[model samples]
Target: MVGRGELTDAAWERIGPLLPGVDGRGRSWRDRRKAINGVSWGSRTGAPWRDLSERYGPWQTLCERFARREADRTWARLLEHVQVRDDFVGAGEWRVSVDSTINRAH
Candidate 1:
């Protein structure tokens, strides 16, 4: 039962191998797929981290992993891979929107 923004089995098969596992103490991270799904949920919804659903596991874990991966360029690498693959499979669509609704004229 994959949600609207979740990674499907085939998508996971492509992405799971590329995620980092070793934590600061070398403890292999658990439930990474679950955490990633939560991350996806956050991105899709633009919701506060504290408001994340429990089924995604702790919000702290998802936030920390997202920050760490972002700092380490893992996200960039993964995006490049996904973009290339999607282009190859003809699923690629590029669009841009500039939203000013959140801007405040102070």
Candidate 2:
């Protein structure tokens, strides 16, 4: 069962292939999707990594996987792919919001 903020099977299908595959010489990593779900959950809930649910595997593992993906620009590529596909399917709506107010430190 998909939990709140976790990627659905369809959503995972769209981005799963974009993640980096494990090298045979290195130690095998945990499931990419589950780790990613942990990331999503943590970000959405604004929770600490150490508080991650065991259902998503160890928080440290998820953090490492996320860092590796970010370092490799896999996340950027996945964003581009998803944006392009969503635009093609007429499902994308781009928007930007700016808060122009500046606060001075007292």
Candidate 3:
């Protein structure tokens, strides 16, 4: 059961292969979908990683996976892929709003 703000089946199908361990080289110790959902939940709700719901598995693992992806530029690649796909499919406006006031470097 995919929740609101979580990736849909179609979306996952497109994005899953972009992630590590989908190539059958090695087993992934964690469930990728759940980890991704946890990341999404934290980012969308602006919740601390430690506060992620258990259904997404260990918060630390999810946070680490998110950070690893970020460091490796996976997130940026995913975004670019999605944008291209959406453009080809004629998907409507993909707008993003950022509140810089909440983004102070500390």
lDDT of 3 by residue, 33-61 (tens): 87887898999999998899999998877
Query: Which parts of model 1 have CA positions greater than 4 angstroms off?
Result: 97-106
TM-score winner, 2 or 3 = 2
Give the alpha-carbon lDDT of every model: 0.87, 0.83, 0.85
Query: Which residue runs does candidate 3 get wrong by more than 4 Å?
Result: 22-27, 96-106
Residue pair clashes in candidate 2: none
lDDT of 2 by residue, 10-85 (tens): 9999888877677564666557788888888887889888998998898887887778778888888998999999
Report the Cα lDDT for candidate 3.
Answer: 0.85
How close is each model in CA RMSD to the real structure?
A: 3.0, 2.6, 4.2
The lDDT of model 1 is 0.87
Best by TM-score: 2
Residues 15-102 of candidate 1: C-alpha lDDT, one tens digit per residue:
9999877857545667778888999899889999999999998898789878988999998999999999999999999788978997
Candidate 2: segments with Cα more than 4 A from true spot: 102-106
TM-score of 2: 0.84
Candidate 2: residue 33 lDDT (0-100): 81
Most lDDT-accurate candidate: 1
